[model samples]
Target chain A: MVKNRQWRLISFPSGRPEASNWELVETEAPEVAPGHLLVKALYLDVAPYMRGRISPQPNYAAGVGLGEVMVGGAVGRVLESRSPGFAAGDLVVADFAFGWQEYAVLSPGDVRRIDPALAPLPYWLDLFGLNGLTAYFALFDAGAMKAGDTVLISAAAGSVGQIAGQLAKLAGCRAVAVTSSAEKAAWCREAGYDAVIDYRAAADLPAAVAEACPQGVDLFLDNTAGPIHDAAMQNLALDARVVVVGTASLADTFGAPDTGPRFLRQILVARATVCGFLFSDYAARHEAGRARLRRWYEAGRIHSKFDIAEGIASMPDAFLRLLTSRNLGKQLVRLEGD
Target chain B: MVKNRQWRLISFPSGRPEASNWELVETEAPEVAPGHLLVKALYLDVAPYMRGRISPQPNYAAGVGLGEVMVGGAVGRVLESRSPGFAAGDLVVADFAFGWQEYAVLSPGDVRRIDPALAPLPYWLDLFGLNGLTAYFALFDAGAMKAGDTVLISAAAGSVGQIAGQLAKLAGCRAVAVTSSAEKAAWCREAGYDAVIDYRAAADLPAAVAEACPQGVDLFLDNTAGPIHDAAMQNLALDARVVVVGTASLADTFGAPDTGPRFLRQILVARATVCGFLFSDYAARHEAGRARLRRWYEAGRIHSKFDIAEGIASMPDAFLRLLTSRNLGKQLVRLEGD
Candidate 1:
């Protein structure tokens, strides 16, 4: 019997998560059923969205129950298989339901096969996974980004933001990045963003955005939806499209309602559209999105960056750092060597 | 020389407009210049949109300058014409730039000719004009409303609300109306709304909306964007569309920023879209919208109700009443016999 190490939610987080909220323990792995496979976790992704799952209240997805494994996405290798579709040594990626565990018994259909040759194992958690798919659909499908359009992305150095900025540039649109620090801003520029707004340095974000995008933003990919969203709303061009992706800044205030500048007048005046996009809704077309991402990766037109924490024990800390914007790119915990 | 009476804004209103904010004066009418026609105003429209124009800050349209005629739409008869497009005794409609006045010399190109026989002369300012066009494009175009969709219209006894409720019903969608009083609620029922929520009676608006639309709202035509908008945001269905048409309740709070519950989380979770629609953006397709409206009117599938205040002198009072929700349906000042 294999010993499995798991991080479970001991308590729901009131604001920002703490170490006390989680309990790391070791237990024997469950027996693999006839149609299931035993998988050894390689790399686990800790994202801003995980903050919602640990909250006491329910979100779009189910909340993690007390004593349950802390939910997350993980790249794993099929150690043993009882299912006809999979065999030992095959690499696969499981979505959030897989949780933060060293070993898991998953059904064949629960995980998607990935080629290690595409990029890297951690990249499957970044570029070829939820992050990349989110950027792809939010920009092209929801925002309806077009050539000559000015695209503004908030949290510009995050996993999705980096890819979105590069994608916007590739689409022949003017890409602007809003980052919290000078370091992230420089990274965004390297990623092919035409302009960068250091939101931390600027006294007035709307004015800064207006200065960067003189014609005003035609498409906005909003990740931090507090002041950044309010600023973007102020400078929207006629018929602007705002894609609501994430709200990392408000992670601490999830239990209470957040109040900000009203957007109705600006929206009405500019004839703009603000849409909330959840990537999972486009599950049927994910392969299409992945194929395009692969081509872009092969062409070296896009790149992925990972801020990885070594070992399974660092999962909670990595997630906490991600929530506070301490990480530069996709936050991940490396569980096992390639 | 004819005496031209005018209602001019003497000061920008701080909150709800008062008679003291405007001045009624008599001036000698200018001679009809070549290429211009003398228009004797027959009916002047007083709408919620007019509140935006009288504000200190510029809205989608320019604010009415102090000492200038209060900007509004008006239907008039051409007394004399020197331009090829217009002739003496022809009826015409002029948009908001025309200003509130009994007589004015305007370029023939400044106004569009209208047929009184198509409907009543006042209907040109109601169902056949801006109000009708707003409801049409907002529901059908921006909202992309489908049959079996549930629509929630705020301020449902108002002009646009009444028409929108009926339009949603005609489209085979469930129409729920949120009004301020029992009387307006009864009127909305008569207009074919499936459900009515008197917002004044509900202690918890979101709960009331959830109770009214058990399945959640697919399309929201929001007129008052304070608490009602907050409630609607809380109960959005997946891929729901919110059309921000007006903010009548916030008419007094124009000087200061209005803060309410932030909608980004709700918007993101539901994968919904909120759009601010200005009818003028669809100017190229106004005729198509009008043709559809005319057909509906002819087929008795649509109807228009007006609360008429006699004479141009009552324009200020009519507009004030409309702003306070004191007037029902489309508020208008009948300057002359129809």
Candidate 2:
């Protein structure tokens, strides 16, 4: 029997997550049952969305209960299998259902087969997984992005942010990025953004966004819904479309109410539409989206940078880094290297 | 030359209008020019949207300047015509450009001819005019009201609200009304709402809304963007559509920012869409919309009630009644006998 080490939620976060809120536990990995397989976590993804899973609020999904294994996604390898669909040593990727652990017992339906030979294992989570699917549907479907749209993407150097900017560029839109640092802004510019606003360095975010989009933003792909959202609200072109994908800046207030200048007036003034969507809504067409994303990746039309931490012990820290917007790209913890 | 009495904006309001903000002026009416017609005002419209036009804010339309005629809509009879499209004795309806006056000078393009023989003159400003068309397009296009949708309409006894609630019922959706008082709620019930919530009397607004809409609101027609908006935000069903049609409650704060719970989190949690649109955006298709509304009105499928204040002197008071939710159905001012 293989030994499994996993992190379990001890308490819900009051504000930002604390290390004491999680407890590490060791147990024997469960033997495979009929129609099920066991996977050893290769690389665990730490995303901003995970913060919602720990909060007791009206989230899109059910929250992780106290003493429950902390939820996450990971690229894993099949260690043992009782299902005909999977064999030992086969590579797989699990989304959200994969807890923050060294080993997870899952059914064949719980995971998708992935080929490491096609690209690096971490790339499945970073570029070809949730981030890619999210950016594609949120930008084109929710945002109604079209040719010549002035697309403003917040969190432009992060996982989904990077992919959305490149996709906007591919669609012949003027891609303007709002990132936290000069280095990330430089990276965004090199990645084909028409203009980059380093939000942390700007004296006035709304002015910076206005300067970058002189004609006003036609499609604002909002991932950070705080000051950046307010700035975009103040600079919408006629009939603008805003897609709310993530609230990276509001992680601390997930379970409580936060105040901001109401956006309804701006929405009316510009005749704009604001929509909120989750990637799971497009799960049926994931394969199609992944195919186009893979083509873009192979042709170097899209690129991704991995910001990885060392081990299972770094899971909470990696997530904190993501919550604080410290990670440059996809934040991941390597339980074992690819 | 005709003697005319009109109300001019003397100052912008800080909160609600207090009757001291308008100036009554008596002057000789301008004669018909090369392309303009002179009309004697019969009925003037008082609406919630007019509140935005008086404020110095980023509204959908420009604010009425001090010393300018208080902007409004009216049904009138042409006294003299200098345009080929119209003749003396023609009945017409002018929108926005028709001031709160006894006479107006307008170009042929500024007004639409009305057949007084088809319906009562006041119906042109109520059931068969902006109110009906706004309800039609907003419910179908912006609210995306599908058959069987549980629709929640705020300010349900107001002009557009009454029409929208009925339109949702005609489309086979469950029409629910949120009104200010029990009397208005009773009117909404008589008008075919499946449920009615008297927001002013509700001990817990959210609880009242949830109890009324046990299945949650599928389409929320937001007319008053304050507490009613918050209650609806707390109870959105999956894939709900929220159409911001008017801001009756926010009128007092139109030129300044107001604090409210941020709605992005609620929006994302429900995977919902919120859109803001103006009836002017559908101006090109107004004729078709008016025809349908006329058919509905003639068929007894739709209804309208007029809460009219007498004479041009009552214009500001009639408008203030609308702003304070003191008037029900289509608020109007009769400058002359119908």
Please give each candidate's TM-score.
Answer: 0.77, 0.77
lDDT of each: 0.68, 0.68
Q: For each candidate, what is chain B's TM-score?
A: 0.76, 0.77
The regions of model 1 sitting more than 4 angstroms off are A261-338, B261-338
Error of 1 at B141 (Å): 0.7
Candidate 1 chain A: worst-modelled 10 consecutive residues by lDDT:
A329-338
Give residue B306's lDDT in candidate 2 (0 to 100).
34
Per-residue lDDT tens digits for candidate 1, residues A40-79, read: 8776655666776778764556788999987877778899
In terms of lDDT, model 1 sits at: 0.68
TM-score of 1: 0.77
Candidate 2 yields a Cα-based lDDT of 0.68
lDDT of 2 by residue, A112-168 (tens): 888676555665665555665666666666667899999999887776777778778
True contacts kept of 2: 0.13
